[model samples]
Target: MTSSPAAEDGVVRADVWLWAARMYKTRSIARQAIDGGKVDLNGHAVKPARSVRAGDVFELTRGNERIEVRVLAVSERRGPAPDAALLYVETERSIARRQAEVALRRQHAGAPRPPGRPDKQDRRLLQRLKKSIRD
Candidate 1:
C-alpha cells in the first residue's frame, strides 16, 4: 500500500481528507456538507478546498449525529478502514455526547405510541382541541 501524502506534504483539502478518512462515503457528499455548513474546521466554517493539517479540529454534523474530531494525519487518497481510522481521532467530549444521545433515544424508544392513524372520532376530538386552543 502507498503511504499517505500527509507524510510528505502534511496537508490535504478538507473534503478530500474527509473522504479519505472515511468520514463520508464520497468526496461530493463531503463537499456538499462543507457547502451546506454542516462542517466546521478549527471552530470556523470551512470550504471544501480548505487546507487541513495534522491536529486541526473539526466539528461535523451527519444526519442526527454531531461529531468532533481532531485530525491526526492527512491523506489525499482513500484507504482501508483501519488506515482511514488512523487519520483522525474523535474527541472525548464528542464520544460522551454521542453515548448520551444514544441512551436518551433508547429511553424514549419504549414510549407508548398511538396504535395507528386516528379514527374519525379522534380527528374530530383533535379539531375540537385545536379550536379551543385558538379561541
Candidate 2:
C-alpha cells in the first residue's frame, strides 16, 4: 500500500471522511453522493471540499434510510473495516429506526394495492399540463 494522510486529526476532507467511515464503497462514490445531494454536512449540502472535524455530525441518505454519525477520527486510506469503523460513531436510535423502516418497506413490497380504475384527478392533471405546455 502507498499513502500519506493529508490531515493529522480533524483536517480531513468530507469525501475522505465519508469513504473512511465506510459510508460509501469508494471515494468517487462518496463524491458523487455528495454531488447528488445524498449527503449532508452539519445539516446542509456540501461539496467534497467541505472540512470535517471531530464531533461534527453528518446526515447521510442512501435510499429511504437516514444515518446520523458523529466524526471520531479521520483517515484517507481506508484501513480494514474494523479500523475504518473507529472514524465514526453511530447512534442507536437512528440504526433501530432505519432497520424498522427497511423491514417495513421490504414487507410491504409484495402487498396488493386496492383494485380500482385510474382516478379522475390524474386524468385532469395530465390533460391540464398538456394544454398548458402547448402555449
Candidate 3:
C-alpha cells in the first residue's frame, strides 16, 4: 500500500509537531507536557521523542480542556496561527466534549463574593464580638 505525499513525508518529532501546530506555547512546554503524560499518541502515552506523522491522532489535556486532533500535515518550524492550524484537524467529538466541559465549569462558578469589606460600624461590631468571646 502507498501513502499520500503528506503522510509519506509527514514525520516529525512529537514535541516539535505540537509546538509547530500551536498546541503549546513553545517546544519546551510541549516536551514537558509529553513527559508529564498530558499528551497521548494514538490512545497511548508517548514520549517527547515520539514521531508524529500525517493521519496520526493525539489526545492532549491542558487543565480542564481535553483536545483530540488528527494530524493533517507536519512542519518543523512554528508559524502563524493559520499556518499552524493546517497541521491538525480537531475532531468534532473533541470539540463537543471541550465545549461541554466549558459549560459545566461556567455552571459551577466559584462562590459569590461579598459586596465589599465590612464598614467601620460592621468592623466595630465584629471587634466587640471578638473581645466578648475572648473574655
Name the best candidate (by TM-score): 1
User: Model 1 compared with the native: what TM-score?
Assistant: 0.93
lDDT of 1: 0.95
Q: Each candidate's TM vs. the true structure? A: 0.93, 0.72, 0.75
lDDT of 1 by residue, 63-106 (tens): 99999999998888898999999999999999999999999999
Judged by TM-score relative to the true structure, which candidate is superior, 2 or 3?
A: 3
Clashes of 1: 0
lDDT of each: 0.95, 0.85, 0.89
Best-performing candidate as measured by lDDT: 1
CA RMSD (A), model 3:
6.1
CA displacement after TM-score superposition, residue 20 of candidate 3 (Å): 0.4
lDDT of 3 by residue, 1-135 (tens): 554454357687899889989999989999999999899999999998788888999999887688999999888878899999988999999999989988888888976876899999989999999999999
Supply candidate 2's per-residue lDDT for 2.
46
